[model samples]
Structures are given as C-alpha cells and as structure tokens.
Target: MDEYRAVALGTSFMMLSTTSFIGMGDIVTKKSLDWVLSNPKIGNSLSILGRLMDDMKSHKFKQKRGHIASAVECYMKEYSATEEETIIELRKQVNKAWKDINEEWINLTTIPMPLRLRTESCTYQ
Candidate 1:
C-alpha cells in the first residue's frame, strides 16, 4: 500500500487499541510525563500489529456482509491492491512493528524502567 495509508492505518489502529494502554501504570513521572504518556510509538507498534492481524483475519467475513471497513479496505481503496497483496503488505507491517518493539526493548529510554515493565506486561497480557 501507499506510504500515507500505511501510516494512517497504523496510527488509527493504535488509537483503536486504547484499552491496551490502561495498564501503562501512569506516566506523570519526570522522565515519562508527557511524550511517554501521550505519544508512545514503541508501545503503539504492538497495538498496530494486533489491529492489522485482526483486520486481516476478519475483514473478508465482515465486509461481505457490509460491516465496518478495516485496514484492508483502506489499503485496497488507496492502492487498488488485491486482498492477497494487501494482506501480504500488512503482514510486512506487522513484522516491522515487532522489530520496532524489539529495538525499543533493547535501547534504554527516557521512560522509567518500572513503567516500561508494566507496559511490557500489559502487552503480554
């Protein structure tokens, strides 16, 4: 899919997974006050991956009966790609998101270590 739609889907899916952040353990600490609480790309990657995978599995069944449009729909509409191509590209996105999360784990962040562990636990659950 096109770059713009890909980013939009990721970000939208991130927002859609807001429940996943409920266990972020609050981020008003000095290090992780604003950006960590507000715009956490590393954690968002997990949500994006989950959303894309879910959409890939459920889109065809849902769309056939005129349910909500998914990331698959957006990609197909934006890039004129077939379902197989869209799913393949989405799988690539999911893989890249996992890599991003892995990289985030390897690097130290401004985020506090304890809250990081909580975020990890939240995702794992």
Candidate 2:
C-alpha cells in the first residue's frame, strides 16, 4: 500500500471506532458529533498510534499469511529504509501522536469530563 492509502485507512478506522464509543456512551447529539468531526487531530493522532503499533506487532504474522502491505511495509518501500530504521521512525511518530492526544485532551474544555474520558478510554485499550 501507498502512504496516502495507509493513512486514510487508519483515519477512517479511528473515526469509526471513536464515533461508536461516543454513540455507545449516549453522547451522539448533533453538537457533540459536530465537535468530534471538526476536531480531528486527536482522532488522527490516535489512528496513527494504533495503526503503527498494530502493524509493528503483527506485520510478520500478516506477511506469513500473504496479507497486503502495512504502513511499516509502505514506509520501508517508500524510504528504502531498513526494518530497524523504519521502526525507530515509526516509534517517534507514535510518541508524537501520544503528545498530540494529551494536548488535545487538555484543551477540550467544552465537553464534559466523563464524556471526554469515555472517548479517550477506548484508545487506551
């Protein structure tokens, strides 16, 4: 897979997961949904973290089963990087994503603490 496609898949996955969690928490009103939609950085950050972590852990297994390229593979191919180098760079990105998540969470004063917790809790697991 290419860079764009890998990123888009991750973003879509994150949005779907985040939205479902919020909906389950009964916080899916128009205003709340709008806020979630408008402020996507946190979700995107979470997506990047989740995608890279999963790919890093499962890439070998997936490859053994003939799965398509993951973000790790895409990065390696695009940059002509070794696995170790790719992993190191991806780890840096994951750390940045965590930082972004914390920053966004701190700035989210409009949402109730409980609702905010509900949205972020899923990402922890």
Candidate 3:
C-alpha cells in the first residue's frame, strides 16, 4: 500500500482485510472493529510483522520484478545494514509482534466474546 516505501502495519492490515472480506466478515467484522479502531496498535503490529515475514520469504522472487518494497528493503535502507542483519532484526520484530498480539488478545477479552464460546457455554451433563 505504501508503494515500496516504509509502511505502518495498519496499512498492511488494511490491505490484508481487503483480500478476503468473506472470511474476515465473519471473524473481524464487529467486535474486532471496535478494538482495531480504538487501538490500532494491535492489528497494525500483526500486519507489520506478517508483512516482514512475507517479504522475507518472497524477497528473492519479488526482487526481480514489480514487487513493492518490503520490510527488509525498508529496514536495510533505514539502518544501512546488510541483508543478514536486516533479516535478524525482522525476525526479532516478528517475535515482538507475537508478544503484542498476545497482550492485545488477552486484553480484548473484555469485549464481546467469540461465537466459539457457545460450545463451551454448554453445561456438563
């Protein structure tokens, strides 16, 4: 979305959301929107981390053609680091993203629960 420039995770997440509105409609439609709008950090971090990972995996193929600038490229440019160092930093970023995801998900429990709770809601016979 940022056109080969450094992009925030929220923008990546927005693009991801566009791909499969069908699936996301059911999953991230309502409650998720509240949190996403209220505190975009969670979703942004997820998408940013995911984008870095995706770019890492596909950088070789993407580099040859009309691919957008990935996190790797952005980081290398920003930090003036070698490819190896950029990847190491990106992986560290992914780990950090997971930690952020865990924290947000746990905190978001205060919102409307997922439908999965219906199953567990049943009493033991």
Clashes of each: 0, 0, 1
After superposing candidate 1 on the true structure, give the runs of residues whose Cα lies further than 4 Å from its correct spot. 1-30, 123-125
Estimate, for each residue in 1-125, the C-alpha lDDT of model 2 and write its tens digit: 45544554445634664555543555556666666667467777877777778988988898899987787788889999999999998899889989998998889787667667766766656
Best-to-worst ranking by lDDT? 2, 1, 3
User: Which digits, one per residue and each the tens of the lDDT, describe model 3 over residues 22-93?
Assistant: 353466556545443453555566665666778899887888886777777777887899999988988997
Cα-lDDT of candidate 2: 0.73
Residue 83, model 2, lDDT:
91
**Candidate closest to the true structure, highest TM-score:** 2
Error of 1 at 55 (Å): 0.7
Once model 2 is optimally superposed onto the true structure by TM-score, how far is the C-alpha of residue 94 displaced, in angstroms?
A: 0.2
Clashing pairs in 1: none
Can you tell me which runs of candidate 3 are displaced by over 4 Å? 1-32, 115-125
- Compared with the true structure, all predictions reach lDDT values of 0.69, 0.73, 0.59
**Candidate 1 lDDT (Cα, whole model)?**
0.69
Q: Please provide the root mean square deviation of candidate 3 (C-alpha atoms, Å).
A: 7.8
lDDT of 1 by residue, 1-125 (tens): 45544654445433433444455555535455454446577767867766788888898898899987788998888889998898898999999999998998888477667656656655544
